[model samples]
Target chain A: MTLSPIQILVIIAAVALGTMITRFLPFFLFPDNKKRPTFVIYLGKVLPYAVIGLLVVYCLREISFSSPAGWLPEGIAILCIAILHFWRENVLLSIGVGTAVYMLLVQYVF
Target chain B: MQSDNLHSPKKPADKRIKTKALKAAFPHTIPVLTGFAFLGIAYGLLMNSKGYGVGWTLLMSLFVFAGSAQYVAITFLTSVFNPLHALLMTLIINARHLFYGIAMLDRFKNTGRLKPYLIFALCDETFSVLCAKEPPAGVEKRWFMFFVALLNHTYWVAGSVTGALLGSTLSFNTKGLDFVLTALFVVIFIDQWKQQKNHAPALIGLLCSTLALVVFGADYFVIPAMIALLAGLALYRKRAEKGETL
Candidate 1:
């Protein structure tokens, strides 16, 4: 490592501080004492669904579209998950089967 | 005298509730258990390869508690020292957390002493689990959320520590196992879609993120995606407000 121990600790502290700032800032901005603006409340209602979508995309962000094979495993697995989830509406079942399918694809099929 | 008597009975009952909440929360965290363990182990192994020991791995996983940021931190540790740059990178990577906090503002309200920890521990998986899984009837919501966060945190810390100590001893082709997290999010997205009357938000999120990804590439897409997401939602809110008023 190029960094000395103290420098490493300083970087870690800085990272930790930055992380806490992102996580904690919203609560501080819209404290319970003050009236949260309507836009903020609207965001509170809608952002969760949107954020989950964002997360799903974030997970697949590494997949390359230039090659068909690059995206195949994730594409197939997500298809299976959506199908199984809608068919059965079982959370664990869908996630378990989907992940197992993806593991099999990437490990063997792909 | 009356208040003291009331508090006395509630204390034991509170303990019972906490235990029950922990039990209820465990099943919901099973996916995260698999995901965090694999990812954390990968993280720990990376740290070990970089010559950092168990202490550094454990400390980063426990204190920073953000997976992507920690991975970025490893790069920082190996590169020329620049604390300001590290902090900026961390902030950019974790900026999505701001949205999680906004969404959780109400659900986490009235959590009392547990509020700070709940907010502190609101990592991506914890946030998703808490957002999707409401406490079962008669289970205290605050306690359930707390246990969910605590269990995920434990899995991550333990996994990293195990990896740090084990250091590539086990032999398993664990490739693609980390898809559990992706699967978890997709399932939750579906659940939210079904539960909510409006689909615009979910659609907006997917559209904006995908657009940004195409435009910005993976490394830089997140912030642009976040900005586009906020703009899309704001426009959505405006239209919905008009529809409601009319």
Candidate 2:
């Protein structure tokens, strides 16, 4: 769908405003001296991993996993990347090889 | 009290401490710059696909600068611009920043002029760098933070502009490109997992988030999953504390 110029401007304005408010809220609400409560500290520690987990699941939510042909290659590729990443701790190599393998599967194997 | 007086020579010591902190922080810029470059290019491609030209890409990257939010914002633009919807989406998408801000409160407390920009630029990557450590002594922590923010911003702007300029002239399959973000997260998870002996929190996060996704669906899952994960972790912190003590 195409956006008209006015619509685009309005959307931009709305996004900009909303983003600014979110970024600004913490600064306004908490002064420098106020220690975050223990629960918040706990949130800080666990939130990143939780967010990442949510994002990974989000990425895979739409994959058609009913058929072995459709599901197996992508599933294997994710597993390969995850295992390689865990074993070697090399992100670039893991993702690079995983993507290459996934592309080959989608194009030829599947 | 006597110790405070004995350590009255705080200024030089503080300066030394700050310098050391910044030096340690510098190495983190490498991953951030690389990730932002790829993600920024993907965002630019999405915008270009939406019929936006290089000018719009550059302007949005410069002004908006929220990486994933910019991608989502394009869809909002394509539709009728509803202020309420935009607000709700922004809150939902960027709600994680609330945690980022709380984590950063101690580090950012002493910042002066650098405070505003530090707050503005606290994306996931920036938060990763800052949350990863305490600033070393004698280094200007703010400058180090600024450097990371500035470098990542430059990578993003450069990538977006390049992608927009390239447009669709050179067509390549960008299918798995989105996994860059996932790869980043995996790397972070492994890093944190290695550091802390207790893997319960991470495992709980993984399980709760996946369960939530199954129930809520993708569009509505994030906030609920985050709430569940956070609640679960908080409930189990005593275990983690005990592990640390032991």
Candidate 3:
């Protein structure tokens, strides 16, 4: 709200453009008919592992020691996810159950 | 490669095939439906809290469509107008998609006209679904990917609009709902972990990102962690090629 409507639009436009560039540039670099460089192929193969790892940490990054709740809810919920997933090997079940546990802890217990 | 491709069905993406693909793809996207709904609603409420109306939330969700970046943009929208800074922040935050697009180059190669939108809509959840799951027999690959993207996109937009309209009028507490994303990512990580013989990549990712989060703090750890992970992977790969195991 601090910025005028036009300014907000401009920021949004820039963000959209920047995101497109990130998503599209790699494809342009490794177009069909040409062999993708070995390193890019290596990245393609392994990056998913690393990317998901980063995202998992990204979720827990907000919890601070100064707060009393700290990492308890996140830790417990992660345990719930691992258990549910191992027990049933179901994505929805694990996420639903883990989030429910975390929600209940935050909303009621913590 | 050409002979193998020529043997596969070269369906022209007729409506019937596309519809069939949609049917097959919807079930796979159901998990993403739950994840995106809560996350998108959080984003919409964040925008509303900043005094931006439902119109702006819808416009940004429709246009920007970058989940993490949109959340970050809430901060940007309230800050001073510096287009250059906003652009840089967006690029850094979304640089992860470079990996997704690279990984998808081959899958998306012959998708033809649908390629651009597929790339545009190549979000993290969509990437996981398309990259990790294959369509049923006889469903066109392109159409399957299309529906996954379209369905996820629609769910996101719908969730944001609902949240915007509901603006501060919630009858119930919605705190901790964003954990859906965390759980989803953890689930995907476990799937990848179970499937791979090499756990180095996953371990390195977990270690480096956590290290970055601790060292750099949450507000600015992503890009550094990414850079560190890339360097770490390169070193790890070289060691692996040198007859080193584990």
Candidate 4:
């Protein structure tokens, strides 16, 4: 709100442009018509696993170290999710139950 | 080989295949639907609280489409305007999309006209679903992936619009609904962990990100963590090349 409307629009446009660049760059660099390099292909196979791990950590980046509750809510919920997922091998059940547990913890227990 | 014969049967067959793909894709996207609904609504509510109207929320959710970056944009909008910083931040936050694209390059090939929109709509949740789920037998892979991406995008836009319009109206205790995203990533991580023989990358990702988070704090950790991840992977590649088990 401090800036003018045009400035806001410009900032939004900048963000959109940046995002599009990240999404489109890989395709542009390694077009379908050309065979990708071995390293690029290797990275493709392993990167998804690493990226998913990074994403999980990214989600927890905001956990407060100084809080009384600390990491209990997130820790418990994730533990339950892992157990439920391994046991049931069900994606929706694991996510749904885990989220429900976390919600309850933050809403009441924490 | 009549012109009408070629056209007439193909339309219904195409329709049936698309329908089959959509059906296969929906179940995979349900988790994304829940996560996006909560997160997008929260995003819209945040924008509303910052005095932006529904139009801005809709525009952002439609155009920007990246969740964390848009949240950061809220900060940029309120502060002294710096377009360069906003752009840089968005790039850093969304740099992971580059990896998603790399992983999807082959699968997304031969998708014809659907490729552009599929690439455009590949957000984190969409990427996760697309990477994890494959089309069932008789389901076209391109349409399945397309619907997953499209449906997730729709959920996000719809959620933001609903939140903007319902600003401060709902009384439900939705305090921790945003944890759905975290749960989603954790589930996907577990699935990948179970399927892959190499645990090094996963461990490296967690350790590097956690280390970077501790050293740099939450706001500035992601880029450094990504750099560390690349370094770790480089070492991993070397060891594997030497025939070492990891």
Highest DockQ among the candidates is held by which one? 3
- Please, what is the TM-score per model? 0.86, 0.83, 0.88, 0.87
Interface RMSD of each: 2.4, 2.6, 1.9, 2.2
Compared with the true structure, what per-residue lDDT tens digits does model 4 show for residues A40-110? 88888777778887888888988886885778899999999999989998877887899889999999999
lDDT per prediction?
Answer: 0.87, 0.71, 0.86, 0.85
Report the CA-based lDDT of candidate 3 relative to the real structure.
Answer: 0.86
Give the proportion of true interface contacts each model preserves, from 0 to 1.
0.88, 0.45, 0.83, 0.81
Model 4 reproduces what portion of true contacts? 0.81
User: What TM value does model 4 have?
Assistant: 0.87
Candidate 3 lDDT, B1-246, residue by residue in tens:
445442345645455686799999999998788877777887777677779878999988898787888888888899889988989999988988888898888889888778899999998899888877899898889889999999999988998888887876764566887787788899989988898888999999999898888899887898889888999999999998898643
Error of 2 at A45 (Å): 3.8
Q: Write the per-residue lDDT of candidate 3 for residues A1-110, one digit (tens) a residue.
A: 68998999999899999999999998888889898888888888888778889888887889887766988899899999998898899877898899889999999988
Q: Per-residue CA lDDT of candidate 2, range B58-174, in tens?
A: 877877777767878887877775867976897787776776776677677767766888888777777776766555555666667876776677778898988877766867766
Deviation (Å) of B187 in candidate 1: 3.1
Alpha-carbon deviation at B236 in model 3, angstroms:
2.6
What does DockQ give for each predicted structure? 0.66, 0.48, 0.70, 0.65
- Give the TM-score of chain B in candidate 2: 0.83
User: What's the lDDT of the predicted structure labeled candidate 2?
Assistant: 0.71
Identify the runs in model 1 with alpha carbons over 4 angstroms from their true place.
A87-110, B1-10, B171-180, B244-246
Ranking by DockQ: 3, 1, 4, 2
Error of 3 at B214 (Å): 3.1
User: Per-residue lDDT of B94-204 in model 4, one digit per residue for the tens?
Assistant: 988988999899989988778999999989889878877889887878889999988999999999888877776754666676687788789888888898777888888
DockQ-best of 1 and 3 = 3
lDDT tens per residue, model 1, A1-108? 677888888988999999999999999999998899888888887888898889889889999977776899999999999999889998778888898899999888
Q: What is the TM-score of chain A in candidate 1?
A: 0.80
True contacts kept of 2: 0.45
